[model samples]
Target chain A: MSGLLAVESAGALTTVQDRGRAGLAHLGVPRAGPLDRPAATLANRLVGNDPAAALLEVTWGGLALTSDTGVWIAVTGAPTPVEVAGAGRGSGRAEWLPAGGRLRLGTPVTGVRSYVAVAGGIDVEPVLGSRSTDTLAWVGPPRVQDGALLPVGAPHAPPAPLDTPRPPRPGALRVVPGPRADWFADGALDRLCAASYVVGEESNRVGLRLDGDPPERVRAEELPSEGMVLGAVQVPPGGQPVVLLADHPPTGGYPVLAVVHQDDLWQCAQLRPGDPVGFARLRGA
Target chain B: MDVLDLRAFGPAAVLAEVADSAAARSLAAYARAARVDAEEVVPGARTVLFDGVRDVDGLARRLADWTPDGGPERGPLVEVPVVYDGADLHDVAARWGTDVDGVVARHGEIEFVSAFCGFAPGFAYLAGLPEEHAVPRLDTPRGRVPAGSVGLAGSWCGVYPTASPGGWRLLGRTELTLWDPARYDPALLAPGTRVRFVPV
Candidate 1:
């Protein structure tokens, strides 16, 4: 029988996400997945499974639950402290959750999201080639409703827990010149890396609306909506930078200034409403 | 067919725009080439995306040595039956200087092609709406357009394979499921797949 866990309380923005939906954007399905990839990867490693295993993506970090059977569980990402029966389960690391043990994820300390991984994986019907919860599309096969039993997979093989996680060094995110890089009159790329940009409140899983000092736009002409990619830095008429993210539409009309590197995308995912950020140009291929 | 203004967009994507009809066909032509096996291409109402493998030199050569599909017969012409009654029926009818019944007859007569599939999963940019039936998008698009709700947005018309937020004026509904993950062919409409409307 699969390990089952009952959902007690799911935090705001909690959604089931895996590696991501691939090869489907052309049909208009945006890739919906975890904001923090390495964290999600770490969580899966703690449970002895593939890094792409389905995990519960909890944003603003407040998830609580109880396992219905004996199973392994690990919590990763952010500084959301975990506990079993009021005893600390550790934060920024992974731990085992015995059967009938209570697991609680407190508020996030610095990051915007965290992921909880079970021994197997979150067993859910794959919709449109993904287990990612696309709230915008309502293709969510199921949500973390209280008392709803979450189905797990085969038991994990006996193994030692992962080594203590070291925090990532915060640095400026790197980006490649976007498809519409030349739309700007001249030295727009220079100013993009020169100035620090802040994350805006209007941002979500769809895309990040960057604030801070604005990037100047040389042109002010109407643009037809064209294909948009994740990490694409599109400057609207107002010159405010919009960094596309997971769940981004297939197309947009704005001129793309730059594209954030896939490896550095986690920085954009961890940004809060007022977090300041800087861009670094990724040279060459 | 009238050729529209072609503009260079992303180093990866291009836009061949037209005010209406004659250009929709030519735009569809480039869309066919852009959407080959090796290259990742996405077609829109008027623009097409040619992304990945950033060999601008190779792309120019490929286009220079290109061959058209001859005609729409390369792909099967799929007929979609839909009810010609939507929330925007009256509004669309008036724009065409006709009643609701007249709009249905004209709409069903033309052949529409899969110009592109974007906006949502399996949602296609279908061209071939009659000139008179064409109208601009709504001032404010509806937050949720139900799946299978056939509608016309400007000179283009298409079915909502997946429910999403859109501004197209609806004319009816259909039973064909365009997107299904489990199915061998998820999207019923593929580029080059021909489309014809039938009033159900």
Candidate 2:
């Protein structure tokens, strides 16, 4: 099944994404990928597509699309209200979209972004070897807009076999101490783990800004600009922590108190504004 | 050549603090030449961060034994034609106790090597200026500096790849695209590439 998917309405921010463009940080290009990796992978798998195939990343839902031909699709990430031609439907499973069928998604009840995957994936022109869009740097194809037509790739593999439900997302993210942890007053990491932080409204793919007690700094001297890694819990002069994400700058000058483990980054992606966040310290460097 | 210092950046990255920007660039060059298999090797002012390494121990051993081969090779020169009509052109000239033409001449005389890229994609931190030539950033950053606006901050001169909020003192503007994803070389000023600013 292959044809065009017409974008009726793209709510908030919607962009095509894949596994991301890697090894380009030296050029200061960020690795822009889906926030929820497992969700994206599962969506692709359910539709019998390559795990890294580009898919529609719908932020705050409200995405409506109509296919020109029959197609298989699966919606993953924060469970949300879904409908096919005004008929209520469920996600986490593949469903056939008949020709001219309209698929609509409502705002997620708990999460921020949702993934929509078709059998052959979103066949958009790639930039820097990845279809993912870097919102921070304005790289790759422009963000999805209303009335845009998305060409569907040619389907190759059979539909993925049905599998058990995925594990629930955890509230406490695991993290390890950062190299600049010493720059902060002792027990800063402990305070960060013990206290709860609410996600700031300014949060986006670039980073999740946290609003809570500011960690006091022991040294007032400035740290030279250095390479930043994904999931780095960097503390700016304001003392609040900002967890770097997919669109974070390749380098920064702030002191990083800790870095969340890669496995726990999905939780960060699903986090909604005003949602509480807690950290669990991990042993070993 | 000494092993300098190697420290863990995060679980997935290791940062090597070299003696200077030259050493930092050389270390990044060595990593590229040796095929270290890291996802990204980012060189900074005086540090090189190796991210997404599968074999940390093996990489550490190789870096410890590695020596820069008489400094990294200077890649092809990228000439940037600039119109010296920046907002701070007169201010920078006054700070240096020189006239507008003198400031432009001094800036155009030196050949800068791209030491690192940061802040924004293709925004290379070109290093070559002497201490006296270095100038502080603007007291307040502009909301949106136009793309290709050449600027100087501290000891580094860079051209903004895209329109963005910046604190650097604007010195001029260029027509050349600093970053183009569709091009074979996306970043016009990749690290180690020599740069010469031509006044038009």
Could you say which candidate leads in TM-score? 2
**What's model 2's lDDT at B60?**
94
Docking quality band of candidate 2, CAPRI definitions: high
lDDT of 1 by residue, A1-285 (tens): 487887788878678888777666566767778887878888887777677779988888778888877677788777787887568877544466778888888898888888888878888878766788875555545667766688887755643385655468678888767656667857677788889888889988888898766666666676656666667888888788988887778767788878787778777778899998898887762
Top model by DockQ, which number? Answer: 2
List model 2 lDDT by residue over A123-188, tens digit each.
999999999999998788789999999999998997774966579658687888887888989998
Model 1 root-mean-square deviation: 4.2
Q: Candidate 1: lDDT of B118?
A: 68
The DockQ of each candidate is 0.40, 0.84
Provide the clashing-pair count of each candidate structure.
Answer: 4, 0
In candidate 2, position A14 carries an lDDT of 96
lDDT of each: 0.73, 0.90
**Local accuracy of candidate 1 as per-residue lDDT tens digits, B1-200:** 33334443334444444543223434455645465432445555555555543665555445544433344444568999898779998998898989999888888888887766767777777876756667888899999988999988867888988777889999999988888867776778865577988998
lDDT of 2: 0.90
Q: Interface RMSD, candidate 2?
A: 0.8
Off by over 4 Å in 2: B68-73
TM-score of candidate 1 versus the correct structure, residues matched by position: 0.85
A84 in model 2: Cα distance from truth in Å? Answer: 1.4
